[model samples]
Target: MMDTWLTNGKDEGADGGSPTVFIVDDDCSVRTALDCLLRSVGVRVRSFGSPDEFLKSKIPDEVPGCIVLDVRFPGQSGFHLQNEINRMEFPIPIVFLTGYADTRMTVKAMKAGAIDFLNKPFREEDMLDAIAQAINCHRARLSTAKNVKRVRARYDLLTPREREVFAYVATGMLNKQIAEELDISEYTVKIHRKNAMEKMEAANIVDLIRQATTLGLAVHAAQPEGMANGTANGASNRDKPSSAVSNGTEYDCTFE
Candidate 1:
């Protein structure tokens, strides 16, 4: 029989706002040891003697984290836990630690998207590296999710015409130039621009430019040729921030 080393930490779980690493193993000594080792590095950990116990945990909806799982347990095995993770679509990345030197098991875990599989009697450095990788992956996943939500919110708020105006405005088009290009009156252009700006929570053109740029929208000069239309000699309007527009207001930006 292979001895599985599983560990959990004293650091608070996701509720404490730190990233969580759930450890599942049958040995109490192993659990305590892992918990100590993990906590030493500032990672939050939750330990369970069996996979069943971990399943009952109330992980937060917004929390991002990983699981330090064992390959075998007394009750439902580590592979079963992996399957449950799949079925529930748990977002936490998993790293498996096992004493059993089974290539088949390693392949299966990797194919199932496990971040790592460390053989038992592993070096402290190896364990630390695996946990670090899992946490980084979790952070990125959360960021992407947040961006997606923000983008969806922005998209839902915009009207079709407003979106078109937003694109043109982002390209550094002035209201008058946009009006001429769209074959609409300057007054109509102003109305659309104001609505778009308000909806985007952009106080001025600079805020709009930054937000649009973040979303990968292009910023073009309003005039086809370089420089302001009525500028003297060689001076360009782009050289300075315009006094006409105030660069205030926070953008409710999101990826589209």
Candidate 2:
């Protein structure tokens, strides 16, 4: 498994939690310069000389930011490092900095799902733009993750009956149908559904479905008449986010 590297601290220059920027370059000058530049723009930054060192450090659990990784490193190539990061399910998005750009390399990086690639001697504004976009994406991702975590926590609080109701509700079952399935009254199913929605902090059915799925509620797709027949749909739900909590700051969890 590829080792995941994460930034191990709170965001710097946080005004209502501004995004962070991590720079991993073998060249000390590049690191320093980028750090200064990022900091000057109200972005917190951490610099590292090598990928291994970055992997060794601790990163905050969640932050709005992205990693600026050099394509060439002292030991591990950036390409391999990126692949490993993906394998580990790290949360951070990456912006690659390459000294040499080629169609093949660009294709490879894009195919591996890099956010952006910057050639050396590129304009500062371009880097800043990419960084800003990355941080915003990271922030959104963290926000979603927080909500997901909360959803799961609430799901765990439900009684086994409530959990059963939740699954039915997510699969578009009516309270009447769920009651029949579980040998309960429609009123009872409605009560349980309401309780589950309240605990999940969902405003409506759609919100409940979204939040429940995020919490791994194990909902199956509803069949044409499964609700009427009180039969399990049996088909697996295929739509769900990956296990990684990526936003911007690379928190590849594979290492863990």
Candidate 3:
């Protein structure tokens, strides 16, 4: 997908986030008209006369924006730019504006993750609507990215010992069973368990379990040195991790 970006517009959308729109068109008149139109709607506008010119300028990663790109260029095509953007880290949306419309080009842009493909003579209302939708998509993507970063920060607070305890607890092992598995006292297991819950900011065992599964710690819990799987004993493997009862679809995250 084209997880690329372009933007700075006036904060006009009801959703209340700064979204910029970058317009890349070779025709000076087309760029001027689009710049004025988008600015009037409170979208921050930057226009470029060529894809090469836009590429030469720096776009910040923090700005959540979209591009209004002309599909056909003098030499370097918009599709080439889209491909380059796909390799970048940021998530930005793209909407193609073209006068030379065709079935093959439309399908190619859409398949490469463009938000919309509009003909050159497109109406002003339709263009605005498309830009607004692109901004919202960028916002949602940014929010999700923030959530993942926050979740990982919390996970990083755990100690290796706490992490081990977290894994056993996530798999639904009791204090006594975990004690035997790790060759530690039941009291020590309880201490580790309590510390793990606190470090993870988990409200309870279930919450901790969801975080473990979402962060994929439940899988890695087995790999630490001196930690044996149920292959060493039966009580650990008798049942599943018991995280299925949780409706934690919102806690989707992965610590790489």
lDDT winner among the candidates?
3
> Cα deviation of 173 in candidate 3 (Å)?
4.8
C-alpha lDDT of candidate 2 relative to the true structure: 0.69
TM-score of 1: 0.61
Better candidate number, 2 or 3, judged by TM-score:
2
Residues 1-256 of candidate 2 have per-residue lDDT tens digits of 0001122334442324546688988988888888887766556788888888877887664556688999987657888767766664335677899888888988898677677899987678878877766665565566666666567777778888887788778766677867887999999998998898888788988888777566555444555543443344655433232333223233222110
In order, candidate lDDTs are 0.68, 0.69, 0.71
Q: Summarize candidate 3's per-residue lDDT along 201-246 as a digit string, tens digits.
A: 8897778866776565543244435445553443333343332322
Q: Give the TM-score of candidate 3.
A: 0.72
TM-scores for all predictions: 0.61, 0.73, 0.72
Better lDDT candidate (1, 3): 3
Lowest summed lDDT across 10 adjacent residues in model 3 is found at 247-256
Worst 10 residues of 1 by lDDT: 247-256
Candidate 1, residue 241: lDDT: 23
